[model samples]
Each structure stands twice: as structure tokens, then as C-alpha cells.
Target: MTEETNGAAEPKAAAAPSQPVMQVLAQFVRDLSFENIVAQKGITNAAQPDVQVQVNLDAKKRSVENQYEVIMKLKVVSNIKDTQDPMFLMELEYGGIFHIQNVPDEQMHPFLLIECPRMLFPYVRRIVGDVTRDGGFPPLNLETIDFLALYRSELQRRAQAEAAAQTTPAS
Candidate 1:
């Protein structure tokens, strides 16, 4: 065979796969409110109030290019279990701006909801603790969250809701 017909030059090795691109552009507290309902009494009273905490996650694509905003909404309410009087209330909406590239469309939802929130949780938790401590109550140290579990639960909930809607007659 002619030298031109043969593989005269060794073929170059295949290029390495590109790495997935994910980055956090910024993180901030969108909104925060801490209310001491009982004021001095709430602070001075030795009785400990039962504290209830609620957290919600939301995400949306920003108008800017390749950017998304994820928000963590946290609410804490404390009241004396015996008396039902409110001791304090705290609400915080913490947000993060993220830039994600090269992630598959199927993976984007989970990444935004689970991973973005996972990255932002520590800052939100710290602020909550600091505000509570500054508000005169003991520091409210939040426990670590299981984002994967939360994401799975949310998916299951949506699936059930859709199934129910399909079965029910529209009014």
C-alpha cells in the first residue's frame, strides 16, 4: 500500500472529556426579620419555649445570562408550650446567585433545587443562629439538612399531586 494510504502519522489520542462547570456567583440575605414578641419578659423568663422551624426552597433563572437565583426561606416561631404565648418569631429569606454550565437539562432541576440550596444552607443557618442569639434567646443552631432526601420527597409529592389531578374531574 502507498505511504499516503497507510496510517503514516499515528492518530492523536482522543481529547479528554470536559469537566462539568458549576459556580456560585454570590450569596446574600434577601430579607430578614426577628421579632421578640414578649420583649423583656421573653428574654428574662427562665422558661424555655418550644421552638418550631420551617424551611422552604425556591429557584428561578435570572434575567442575566447563565445565572440563576436560589432562595432559602426559613421561619422560626417560639412559644411557651404550657401557656401558648408567643416568645419570638424570626423569618429569613437567603438567596444565592449561581452560574451553571455544561450540565445536562435533566440534571439541572436537581442541581438547582438540591445542590444550590445545599451550598447556601450554611450561611442561612449561621445568620439564624446569630440573630436568635442577638435577640436575647439562646443561639438557635440549625442541624445539617439532607438535600437529597428533601429533593426526593418533593418529587414524590409532585407526582402524587399530578396523579390526583388526573383522576379528579375538573370543576
Candidate 2:
């Protein structure tokens, strides 16, 4: 590389684009409940039970700039596979405080609801397993969740509801 007679060498290349940043400021269980129906009713299990899980998510911006709180609510119900008798029920509200930066404004909603919960899933799973085992049943390991699909499904549900309302005749 050649330098000008009275000048220094060329300057360095432009820097790469900045990547988004996310940090978990804190994580905790906002609320938890477990009901052991089988134990309460004094029933014995003779076969494997059927289990179903449902999840809901919510996020809000905090008073502090760039900080947000995200909550994941989960409900698990287990019943006798054949008899359909209630076995146990569990509900947990887990939350995380996050500090996020560099994410585009248009993407913030998806980022908070999807990525934040994904980061907190491991802890939530551990809590569920422990609660089930301590409540007198084998530990239940949760299956991996698809946050992207969940987000899409929620959007579709809202759109359908809005369309239905628009089509409904005024009473």
C-alpha cells in the first residue's frame, strides 16, 4: 500500500453491524400450586397416566429503560390413561427480568415473548419436575417448546377474533 507524500496510510475498514444484546437480570417463580388428586382421594394408580400441558406468556416494559418483565404461565394436568380419573394438577407462573438492547423496534414484541421464555425454560422445567416428584409421582420432564410457532398461533388467534367481531351483526 502506498501512502500520500504528506499523509499517513489509509484508515481501517468500517466496523461490523452491532448484534442484539440480552441479559437476564433476574428470574423467579411468581406463583406455584400443586394438587395431588390421587393422594387426596386415596386412590392407587395401576397404569400410566395421561398428561397435558398448556402455556401462556405475557411481557411488559419496566419503568427502567431497556428493562422488561416476562411471565410464563403453565398448567399441567394428569389423569389415568384409561379411566380418565384426575391424578394431579400443577400450575406455575414463572417470570424473568431482562435487559435488552440493539433489537429493532418492530421485533421487540416477538423477542420478548419468544426468546425470553425460551431462555427461562430450563428453570421452569426443573421446577415442574421437582413439584411432581415431591407431590408423590415420578418426575415429569417437559418437552421442548416451540416459541416461534406459539407466537404465530397467538397472532392468528387474535386476527381471527378481530375478523369474527367485525362480521358480527350489532345487537
Per-residue lDDT of 58-126 in model 2, one digit per residue for the tens? 999999999999999999999999989999999999999999999999999999989999999999999
**Best of the candidates, lDDT:** 2
Query: Could you tally the backbone clashes for each prediction?
Result: 0, 0
Off by over 4 Å in 2: 1-5, 8-16
Estimate TM-scores for all models: 0.86, 0.93
- Model 2 lDDT-worst window of ten: 2-11
